[model samples]
Target: MTHDTGLVITGLAKRYGDAAVFQAVDLNVAPGEFVAIVGESGVGKSSLLNCMAALDTWSEGRITHDGVDLGQLTEAQAAHWRREHLGFVFQAFHVLPHLDVAQNVALPLLLLNRPDPARVAQMLDAVGLQGLGERLPSQLSGGQLQRVAIARALVHKPRLILADEPTGNLDPRTAAQVMDVLVAQARQHGSSMVLVTHSEAAAARADRVLHLTAQGLQEPPQQAVSAPNP
Candidate 1:
C-alpha cells in the first residue's frame, strides 16, 4: 500500500495585527501516518489545524496536498476538496440535536450530494453504534454522542482526518474509547490523521508526537513516572 497523497507544509506562519501566532512551521506528513501536535494555549494549535484544513488562510507560507497548492483553491473549491479528501472531529462532537444519530451521520454524505444508506450504516457500525442510529444526541451518553460524531466524520470516507481535542469533552474512560475507535478506523481505512491534544494519554496513542513551541516543533522527552506500590 502506498499513499502518494500526503501533506506538505513549508514556512507556514500565521499572524494577526502584527502578532505572530505561528512562524516558519514546516511539517511533512506521509500518507497513513498519525501525528499529534501538542502545545500550550495560544501557541496556535487550532490555528494550525485551520490553516492545514484550509479553513483559514496563513499569513505567509504554503500548504499543499499531493503538490496541489491548497491556498490557491477558491473557497468553494477548498470546501469541495474537504468533502472529497478530509474529515474532521472536534471536541464538541457537533452532532445536530434535532437530527437522529443516523441523520446526523448522514449530513456529510448529503452535503456531498451522494447520500448512501449503506455507507451510513457502515460508519455507525464501525463506531459501535449499530442499532443506536435512531437515538437522538441528547438521549445518548457523552461516549455515544462522540461515537455518533465519529460516525459522521467517517461517513464520507475522506483521506485525511483532522481531529481537534476530539475527546476533550468526555471523561477519561470515554475519551480513551473514542480515541480507540478513531485511531483504529483511520488506520484501517488508510486515512492520515493529525490530532491536537494536551493530554499525555492522548499523545501517547499517536504514531508520533510533535510539540509546538516558540521555536516550531520539537520532540519532547516523555515524563518518567515512578511505579505505584503494589
Candidate 2:
C-alpha cells in the first residue's frame, strides 16, 4: 500500500515476434494525477493499459508503482495486487447480467472481504445511480450501465484506475456526466488515473494528454478539444 509515490513507466515496450506494437514508451503519472493517452485505433492503447494492470506482459523496460515492480509479481500475486490496488472501467460495461447494480458494484468489496453497505450506497449516489441499485444490468440503458461500471470501479478506493473508452457508447451529454463523475471520484480519493480514449473531449479532461504511436508516447502535436461544460 505505497501511496506516497506515483506510477513510473520507463522504456516500456511491447511486441509480438518481430512486429512491434509500441516501443520505447516512457511516462510518469504522479499520485492523484490523471493522464489520458490518445492514439489511432489498433495502436495498442488497450494493450498498454492491460500491461500496466499486469493483465498483459511487456517485452522490455519496467513499470513500477510506488516502487513495486509489476513484472516481478507472479500471476497469483498480480491478481491479489490488482484487487487491492487497482480499479478498472472497461468500454463494454462488463456488468453481470444477473446481478443488481448494487450487487455488481459490491463485488470488489466482497472479494476483499470488506463489505460496507454504506460505502456501496455512497458510490451509487456519487455516480447518480442512488435509487436504481436494485435494478439489473439488463434493465439499464447503455449510459446507466456505464455509470454502474464507474461506481463499481471507484467503490474500493483503489490507488490506480485504468479506464478504457468508458464513454464510447454514451451520448455527448451522458459522456460529459460520466467524465465528471470519474474525474471527481478519482480526485476525491487521491487515486492516479490513466485513461485510454479515442474521444478528444474525454481526453481533454485529463491533467495531461499524450499521443501513442508505434515509436512511443509523446505530447500531442495538436490541441485536444476540451470537455464541454456540463
Candidate 3:
C-alpha cells in the first residue's frame, strides 16, 4: 500500500450549541513528522484527534490527507480510508479479549487482506512481546497490554498514526519505554504521527510540540530537557 503521506488542517473548529470545543485551528503535519499536542484535561485534545482520524465530525474546517478531503468521503468510504491509511492507539488498550497478542497485532493486515505471519512476529519483537504472542489480554499487565497496542498500531505502517494519551495508564519508566518504541517505529516507516499526551517526557520526543487552547494551537514556552537521573 502506498500513499502521498502528509496531513493539512485548515480553519478547524468544533462546536455544540453555544459551546465551542476549539476553533480556528490550523496545523500541518509533513510526511515523517511527529507532532505532539499538549493541553489541560478536557481541552478537546482527544476530540481534535478523533476529527483528524475521521472518526468524529467537526463543525467547520478542512482535513485533507494525502490530497483526499476526509469530509468529502462517505461513511463507508471513510471506514475504508481509515483501514487503508490510519492506525490509532488510545488510552484504553482496546485489545480484543478473545484474540491472543499475535492475532490482535495481525488484525490490520487481515483487514487489508495481506496476512503475513512474519510481520506479526516482527512487531511482537519490536514492542517487547516476542515470546508472549500466544498470551491473551487477560494474561498481560497494563503496561504489556499497551505494548501490544503500540505493536498493533505500527504493524501495518499506516501513513498516519494517531495516539491519544497512549501512556496515560503506565508508570513513568514504562511510559518512557513505550514512547521510545513509538517514535522509533514511526520514524522508521516515514509515517506522520500526531500524539496527544499530558506527559512531558513523551511530548519532549516529538519533532514539534503544540499546546492546545480555546483560542487555537499555540507554541508553549520552550522547556529545557532535564538531564537523566544517575
Candidate 4:
C-alpha cells in the first residue's frame, strides 16, 4: 500500500519460533485520527504496537510512517526516527524516579539536542500538573503520575502516538480523566494515535475501533437488539 502522511501497516505478522502470535494484520491511521485496537490477552496487541514503533521485529509485512519504511532503518536510524516523530505512553507510567516531573518530560527534547523549557511547562499545564513539575514521581499519586506520562509523550510534538494500555493501571474515574487529557493533547498536536486496550470505555472514544485476531483486523460484530412489544 502507498504511504501517506500517517501510519500504514500492510499484511503484518509476528512469530516466535514456529508459533504465530498474529498474522495478516493491516491498518491505516490517518493524520489526526485516533484508532484503538482491542483483543483478547496474548493476541499480540502490544507486540503490534511495538512493531509500529520499531521497538520490535515482525516476521513479515511493512510498516511505514510518513513515507519512511521502518524495516529499512538501521538501529541508530530507528532511534533517531522515534526521537523525532514518535510518542509512546505506557500503562506503567514509566517516569524516571531520579528525575522530577519536568525533567522526565524534558527528556525527549534533550535527546534531540533541543531543550525547550517553555514547551515543557506548557505540556505540564496541559496535563494538569501546572505547578507540580518540581515533584518527584514518588511524591505523586498514580493518577498524577499517569498525567506526567501523557505530558512527556506530547511535549516533543510527535507525529504519531502509540499507547499500550495507558489506562490499565488507573481506577475507572481516573482512567476517564486521563483519557480526556490524552485525547485533547493528541488532537491539539494533530498526532495520529493508535491505542491498544481491553477497556471498552477507552475504545469507545476512538474514531474507529478494530479487533485484532490471527486472521487480521475487523470491526467487532454488533450485539443483537431485541424487538419491544407494540
Which candidate's lDDT is highest?
2
lDDT of 3 by residue, 80-145 (tens): 989888989999989999999999999999999999999999999999899999999999999999
lDDT, each prediction: 0.86, 0.92, 0.91, 0.91
Q: Which ranges of candidate 3 are over 4 A from the true structure?
A: 1-5, 223-230
TM-score for predicted model 3 compared with the true structure: 0.95
What shift in Å separates residue 24 of candidate 2 from its native position after superposition? 0.5
Worst 10 residues of 1 by lDDT: 221-230
Q: Write out the backbone clash pairs for model 4.
A: none
Q: Write the per-residue lDDT of candidate 4 for residues 1-230, one digit (tens) a residue.
A: 43447999999999999999999999999999999998889999999999999999999999999999999999999999999999999999999999999999999999999999999999999989999999999999999999999999888999999999999999988998999999999999889999998888888889988989888888875531112222
Model 4 lowest lDDT segment of ten: 221-230
Model 1's lDDT to the true fold? 0.86
Error of 4 at 116 (Å): 0.6
Candidate 2, residues 1-230, lDDT tens digits: the string is: 55458799999999999988889999899999999999899998999999999999999999998778999999998999899889999999999999999999999999999999999999999999989999999899999999999999989999999999999999988998899999999999999999999898899889999999988998887755455554
From the highest TM-score down, the ranking of the candidates is: 2, 3, 4, 1
Please report the TM-score between candidate 2 and the true structure. Answer: 0.97
Q: Could you report the Cα RMSD, in angstroms, for every candidate shown?
A: 2.8, 1.3, 1.9, 3.9
